[model samples]
Target: MNMHIKVTTDDKDRALLAAIQDGLPLCERPFAEIGKVTNMSEEQVIARIEHMRQQGIISRFGLVLQHRPLGYRANAMVVWNVPDQEVDEAAKIITAHDFVTLCYCRARRAPVWQFNLYCMIHGQQRSIVEQQIETIKSAGLAPYPSKTLFSLRRFKQTGARFSTTPENERRLG
Candidate 1:
């Protein structure tokens, strides 16, 4: 999709993106702290973030949960081979399930790979996650082909960085 998120020339925009690259502060008002650095009000920080999200510049913005620390062990990614016409409905159904943590509608690869809709199911045990998948499969998913991918190990987990290097003007890193 050709999304046009106006590239602000103001250094404050760069500063704001850079400051929040690591994370938003865990406090009463994190944006206020960001405002202090960017010389923007808390409202301004929130507005800019919302604008970015609206423009699809940032796919998602939120806290990064450390599932293991919170006693969540089974991290399974379930992908469903839903027809493009029905993928949206399938995503809605998948996300409605309490056990489904994250849901996305991605592009479908041809003949070799067909599944597009995906959701993550997290649980304390593999069996629990599997059970949840079974429940999800019954919810308008009996017709669709699906599979669960269990993560053997997390290779990397990092936040997206918006680079403002001179060479790149419109692209985000």
Candidate 2:
């Protein structure tokens, strides 16, 4: 059964959300640092975030690395046309590799896109990324048909934004 739960956010919750919308600061005590900006104690910040997560207000908290600046210039999305029944097992094998940064499955749009299982491989050089793909293929995905699409450009990536009003905007100095 599908159920919808409504969660209300107070002023403090808004402040906390604003403080972390750009991602947490890189510090020994990141929550403590956020506490300073939101005017809440470190424990309050952590507790509120946890409460928000349990309430389904915050679905995910993840890191977005700048691959280009990190020398990962060659990025490829390897798509595989694996049988539906085998997708989960194939994804498990693909995600086990340290080189594979992202792996997921999408529904195939028949007549055009036959591939469903997708994984990302990032490396400093194109050859290295290609070799990594070969290694992955040998690791058990050899029988499946696949294609590698190299990324030519990158667009800006950021976490979800909760508010856009001036009052909800809080930045750490």
Candidate 3:
């Protein structure tokens, strides 16, 4: 059986991680640029990131492209009332799909919201998102009713800043 491993790092490692959390730069030699500021060579930086990933300090790295800027703006949270035993299987199928960016299972409250499996899908138009939902339903998932909730306004979006020390005690290096 597989087991989890915990990562313990110093303040320097925390700072290095913080520098990378914003997403990698788009320019060529991005690691070199980052290395200059972090006092690490490009190869060292790359190797550290790889080590962190291997040790489970970081789940994964990704780029967050602005879909709206790319002209693919329509987005919605699609939820389904998946069977308890099949929730994991259904989530795998949903997340494995190219149209899905986010997929997970959440607690369900019947009558109000029976949806247990949720996925976020984005497309160029609302019709396309709806069509994807139709395909998902037609894939023999009609037994579990689904609902589409489109985002109206993005009020606030934030991420956690992990630190080796408590917030009040941390000082700039």
Give the top-scoring candidate (TM-score).
1
Rank by lDDT, highest first. Answer: 2, 1, 3
Regions of model 1 farther than 4 Å from truth: 1-11, 24-63, 170-173
Overall lDDT per candidate, in order of appearance? 0.80, 0.86, 0.76
lDDT of 3 by residue, 24-89 (tens): 678999889778877989998888888888787777677646667687778899988888999877
Model 2 C-alpha lDDT per residue in residues 1-173, reported as the tens digit of each score: 01367877687888788789888998899999999988899999999999999888876666767889999889899999999999888988898899998898888998899999999988999998999999999999999999999999777666666674664444421
lDDT of 1: 0.80
Off by over 4 Å in 2: 1-15, 25-41, 50-64, 164-173
TM-score of each: 0.73, 0.70, 0.72
**Alpha carbon deviation, residue 132, candidate 1 (Å):** 0.5
Each prediction's RMSD to truth: 4.2, 6.1, 4.3
TM-score of 1: 0.73
Q: In what order do the candidates fall by TM-score, top score first? A: 1, 3, 2
lDDT of 1 by residue, 117-147 (tens): 8899888999989888988888888799888
